[model samples]
Target: MIKQVLKNVGITLALFILMINASAQKVTLLQQGRAVSIRGLSVVNDKVAWVSGNKGYVAVTKDAGKTWIWQQVRGFEQSDFRDIEAFSDKEALIMSSGTPALILKTTDGGANWQVKYRNRDTSVFLDAMDFHGKYGCAMSDPSNNHFVLFETTDKGNTWKAREMAKSPLARNDEAAFAASGTCLNIFDNGLIKSNSILMVTGGSVANMIQAHIDEKKWSTQQLPIAQGRSSAGAFSVATNGKNWVVVGGDYQRDTRTDSTACYSNDAGKTWKIAKVTPTFLSCVQHIDSKIYLATGTAGTYLSKDEGLTWTKIDGGSYNVCIKTQHGKLTLLAGGNGKIAMFSMK
Candidate 1:
């Protein structure tokens, strides 16, 4: 009888420790209270990362998130850098939105920036930028009944227009969210031998995954998320070839809990709504095949069971969360120039 009682106590203790660890996990602010609003973040490794934002603000942190070196591109103070991609501590790219959509690159840390792409038309609004090695692309809202995409093969030194014939026609009123710079992602889709550029759209079309499968074909699958208005619907998506997770909600109604998240395990043959969803989680990234971290203006959430359920680990507002592509580091960034460190251990 004593042996059984001791074994039961051990089990209870183990579970208690796990619960404590889970609850004790919270984001630690490393930077904040600045004037700019941060949305774009790129964590290249455990020790190197970068973030870009409004008013031409860009920052680099070499000691993880402990400190940052900030700079505003000398002559571009009015630009809103919506997305950033960092390849290393010294090399990075930032893409601005709004009229005069621009792409800039820096090689000597943040000291100097060279414009690589620009469009001044009123309709040109670049949303997000993603890369798979030297091959990369930037996406913009639909124009003239078609989506606009730009491709880069020589890093950020040059960019080319994707043939309009290859870019699939966009639905009426469909658009992508730039709130977190995550609505468009490019990586190996696993189904095809070549990589696929995947983009998620909102607005009247609700949430749909638009996959540029190859040079000549495009495919799509819809995600069940909040919609019906300009401010509602999916804002971000991430996939590990098989299981896919999407998170978003009405950013204008950020407190609503219904239909804010969903997941698909069979590459979008079907999707299941998250039982416990985050409120207005506009961005999501896979920590592993099962774990994911998401955030937005509402707060931050962590999911351990493939996004079916989540725990609101942080109540502080953030626009985006990202884990190191090849390391264990994770970080979150948001408005007021807030940057915080997070851990999944």
Candidate 2:
């Protein structure tokens, strides 16, 4: 009877610990009501960050999130700058979706932007882009049954589309989500931890696409997330070297929890659907080896036990959440120019 009593007590203690880990952070809003719907976020460090959104809005902060200098690119007032990659307070690249796909680079902070790449095709829609040192890759929806890819060797100043033979083939109705710009990234991480480009697609089918630096071909793994429609599937993926976490659901059904998240430890060879998942997540960032953060239209969530379980710690609508590239400072941004900072409680 004493042993049984001790076992019950141990289980109760563990449950309590998990509960504490679930609500481990506090979110503080730094800005709101600016008339822009932010979807692009990049944190250069604890002291610098940038965000881009619809209506050609781009905001940057040099003193963390204390104040933001907002800009609306001239001659592109209607452009929706959905993804931004920042190298510092003054140099960055912004990509726009919709008809007449565009990529622009700004060297004088937000003062002027020079077009680096432009496509006026009615069917072309750029989704996301990421960099590895000076090498950068960008993705667009299918063209000629294959995903169009562009690469830049000098940061993002110039771009050239990869040969059509090298681009990954897309299924009949498969496409990528441009919600958070976290759905695609290039990193030297995985089982081997070498340079690999990873991208997630959603539509009639959901899949993960990977291309290794040493290999000449692209490979894919199906993600077990919401699918069969345009509004579902994986939206974001983050990894702490080897372990990977992917989160997304039917954005139209933002509150449903089933098939909303999953995890993989052995690269993309296999995955296990998270037992506890957050609602329709557009962005997820690895906070540490064991902690991760995700956010979407529903709210923001945190996971202390990797991606096994997540708890809603704040009820803020956001399109993207990110941590500083080299610092621990974390921030979230969404529509209506909402921006918030997350710090450990």
Candidate 2 per-residue C-alpha lDDT over 1-345 given as tens digits, one digit per residue, 9 for 90 to 100: 999999999999999986776555788999899999999999999999999999999999999999999999998899998899999999999999997899999988899999999999988899988888898888899999899988998999889998888889899899999998988888985365466788998998889988875466888889989998989988999988667899999999999998999988776789889888888899999998789999999999988777988888888899999998698889999999999999887
**What are the per-residue Cα lDDT tens digits for candidate 1 across 26-134?**
7888888999999999999999999999999999989988889898889999999999999999999999999898999989887889999989888878989999889
Each prediction's TM-score against the native?
Answer: 0.94, 0.94
lDDT of each structure?
Answer: 0.87, 0.89
Q: What's the distance in Å from true for residue 25, model 2?
A: 0.8
Count of clashes in candidate 2: 0
